[model samples]
Target: MKATWNGVTLAESDDTVVVEGNHYFPESSLKREYVSFSNHRTSCAWKGQAHYYSLFVNGEMNPDAVWYYPEPSEAAAQIKGRVAFWKGVKVEE
Candidate 1:
């Protein structure tokens, strides 16, 4: 699978895990230079707190477009450290 925004592929990997209809891509798939920490955060009953990331591509910024569970709830612990993107970002197989 791949994560793309503004025609830039920020992450790509064959080892993505799908949980609750979201594709949790591995951190290794991401292009580190294009992603930065975001102030945004949200909680899911099963997943726990999700940290966000803003994606920068060729000077364009997409805030809170990527999110992950730094420390997941026991129910979602398998996806800990994995990332998922949304808010106009595309994740495709």
Candidate 2:
């Protein structure tokens, strides 16, 4: 799968975890230079807490567009350390 935004390929990996209809890319697949920590968080009952990341590419900023569960509940352990994107970011096979 590949994660693209503004025509930029931000991440791509053959190995991705799908959970709750979202494809979670492995941390190793991300373009770290285009990512920065975001002070945003949301919680899911089964997934636990999710932390967010802001994406920047070609001078464009996509705030809180990426999220991941650093420490997920047992039910969602498979997605731990994997990231998902939204808000106009496209994930394609």
Candidate 3:
């Protein structure tokens, strides 16, 4: 699977976890250079706190486009350290 935006392939990985229709790509798939740490956060009782990564490609920024559970709840342990996307970023199988 690949996560793309603004003509850039931000991340790609064959090993992914699908939870609630969202594809959580392995951390290795991410392009660290294009990702900037963001202050945004969200919560899910089962998943714990979600840390965000803003996508900055060619000077265009997409805040909170990527998120992950660094420390997941027991119910969501399978997706820990994996990243997922939203807010218009394309996730292609």
- For TM-score, the strongest prediction is 2
lDDT of candidate 2 over 13-85, digit per residue (tens): 9999888799999988999999998999999988999999999888999999999999999999899879999
- Backbone collision count in every prediction? 0, 0, 0
Q: Please provide, for model 1 over 2-78, each residue's C-alpha lDDT reduced to its tens digit, 9 standing for 90 to 100.
A: 88999999889999889989899888788999898898999998889999999889889999999999999999988
Off by over 4 Å in 3: none
Candidate 1 vs candidate 2: the TM-score winner is 2
Residue 89 error for model 3, in Å?
0.7
Distance from true location, Cα of 72 in model 2, Å: 0.2
Q: CA lDDT, every prediction?
A: 0.89, 0.93, 0.92
Clashing pairs in 1: none
Clashing residue pairs for model 2? none
Error of 1 at 30 (Å): 0.9
Candidate 3 structure quality by residue, lDDT tens digits, 21-84 = 9999999889999899899888997789999999999889999999999999999999987999
Kindly indicate the candidate among 1 and 3 with the higher lDDT. 3
Quality of model 2 by C-alpha lDDT:
0.93
Q: What's model 1's lDDT at 6? A: 93
Error of 2 at 57 (Å): 0.8
What TM-score goes with each of the models? 0.95, 0.97, 0.96
